[model samples]
Target: MKKIGIYISGLGQSVHQESIEKYAMRIKNELSYNDTGIQYDIKSEKIFYTQDRESTVVSIFKSKNDSEQELVYKLYDFQYHEILTTKFKTKNLLVKNLILFGLIIKKLPQIFLRIFASGGFDRPYLTFYAFTLLLLISLAIIFLIPVSIETASQLNFSVTIPEDIRSILENVKSYINHFLPISCIFAKIKEWLVPVTTFILLVIPESKTLITSLATEFACVDKYIGNGEQSQLILGNLDLLIEYIAENEPDSKIHYHCYSFGTIIAMDLLFPIGNIPSTNVRNRSALLITIGTPHEFINAYYPRFYNNRSPIMEASLTWFNVYSVADALATNFRKDMNRGPAEFGIKDVLLLPENINYEITSDKKMNIFNFFSMNSIRMHKCYWDTSPNGQSCIRLLFQKMKQQDFI
Candidate 1:
């Protein structure tokens, strides 16, 4: 039977033809190992359709020994990174900031829940760490102010001052004394207000790179929240692509491999049976694999978007969700009815053994600080890494795929 894999990338990671070709080659090599004993070769081609949108298909052909090459797998890379360029105009800065603050206030509960939900504290404590560092720096500056002023005053000078200069100095001293209390009060107020002011500044479009990245993430999430334009566009493309494949290859078994935010897109496309292709399609076997997904994050913050109704599962489609607690953004796609949508049809699998200590470096010992530092970020991308830790996860994933005859 012919197998087809559709790969959907997440935020900031757009796959080009060269990248997809490399990815297909990696999969081909993995399948050709002793685990499968199937030698495979790939042929990649570009598919162009409506709206000038394009997709790349890497066709994998397999053969044993000197046998004739037979088509076995087709990997299609679908990218929607153009959605990031969607502009969110803010003509009135004050109004925009006020609206953002209001939304944040309304979602404070959900935000806190996300911070303390599960996994490591890296993502949860990132803002707290930044705030703490800023507070320490401010305190250091405040501490040096009086000391520097006193040191300058203590500088003994034997030179006699002129009468006019002395009078001017006295007048300046009097003015300083008169306004010292008010200046001190203003300084204290500014110290405390710096964090809030910084937050407002970050809301501006021309803020720090971190804030811009955050804005991009939120913008993408907003598009997928409701039936937004990006949502409709991606879902439409998926539907059309699947239908086309089903028509052209009746015996093909299609699979979806979505990562990070792409999982949300795939869920939006395939969660409901009505959203899939019509019954006329001959190809019925369809599987879904979601890796490093932030499903819980979206469900926690935007409950209304995903929890409006129960998912109508497609009989021919099966979903397998892979995640690790080490990944700050990834989590077990929870089935809590109150907090998230009822995922009755999906199977959640833990990717790594949390108990086993995975050494990142020789010198850096694993502690609370190091554990929650940059390791969490690296864990998010461990799904495809060839390191020992990632190899174990990949082996487990391949085992799961073998059970479903997906390789």
Candidate 2:
């Protein structure tokens, strides 16, 4: 039987030819050592044309005893890297976006309630942490706009400084009064201009990328979880891929392999709602593999956006969720509050046990910030190379696939 594995990459890791080739090689190597007397070999990979010529396919030869069959891997290349890594051109754009973001944050409570009432999410629906982060950012933006001290001085008005700060303000005002020429020149700078300059100076160095990326990520997360604009665009690609496979390769067995944020996207595709409805693709899928998934992380901090819907439609599908104990972002599906094999209608396998710890080592100097830095985040990226139970994750994946009769 022909097999098609649809690979979805995580945030900012867009699928390209080189990446596809490397992924194909990794799968081939992993499946080669299968103890079940089955071997998978990569023959050739090429971009295959569907009704819409926008799909890449990797052909593999699966052989057992004397029989040989072909398996194809499809790359589900739905792009959002540009959005995630967008750079700000103007300072006004940044402020405008911040204000807009704050407005959206102010409305999240109402939006969450509506979704919760609609039965899309489960109990404990408050997104306290996300709300707090947004609130802080909003407050920071608000703090940027300060009353002009020069304006107060020019009006011949004595600004009522706080008792604790009266001494400092009076000293500063006295110094400014002494340097009247400098004070006059400083006052000529517009009220907004000073703040704008400060904002640019503070943000433009290295923080701009972080802020922009965070803002973009929040916006995307909100849209996707809320089934807003991004959901439609991303899910549309999945729909097209599934439609192509179902129509063109009707007899082929389907597999969905998702990583990191890709798992969330896959979940949305499998258990669709709002603008994107249910599709026959769920019925065609034989297996789903999620590596370094953040399903639990999302459920924890952003409860309202998390999808608590039971995947009853995909009961027949075999799902293998692989995550490392050291990876803070990933979660074991069995331990999730809203998701379990018994509660939901799927066989959720715990690939990594909690006790099984992988030592996190790096050559660089470690610090407190390193815990929250990219080094820690890279833990989620180590699943491809890290082994559990003395076997590579890919090998375990193959074992699971064989157990589920997918191989």
Give the candidate number with the greatest TM-score: 1
Provide the lDDT at 191 for model 1: 64
On a 0 to 100 scale, what is the lDDT of residue 244 in model 1? 68
- What lDDT tens digits, residue by residue, belong to model 2 across residues 369-394? 44324343446557554322233466
Task: Give the whole-model CA lDDT for all candidates, comma-separated.
Answer: 0.55, 0.54
Candidate 1 local lDDT, 1-407, one digit each (tens): 77788888776422212256666666666666744666678898888644577788898887756968877678888777664444544323333333333444555555565567633322434322322332332343344444334434435566565667556655655565586763456467556555544543443333333233333555456556743656666677777777667777777777777778877777766553234433522245367777777765565556455543323434456666676655556655443212232233222221221111222233333465543233444455556643322243444555567777887
| TM-score, model 1 to reference | 0.63
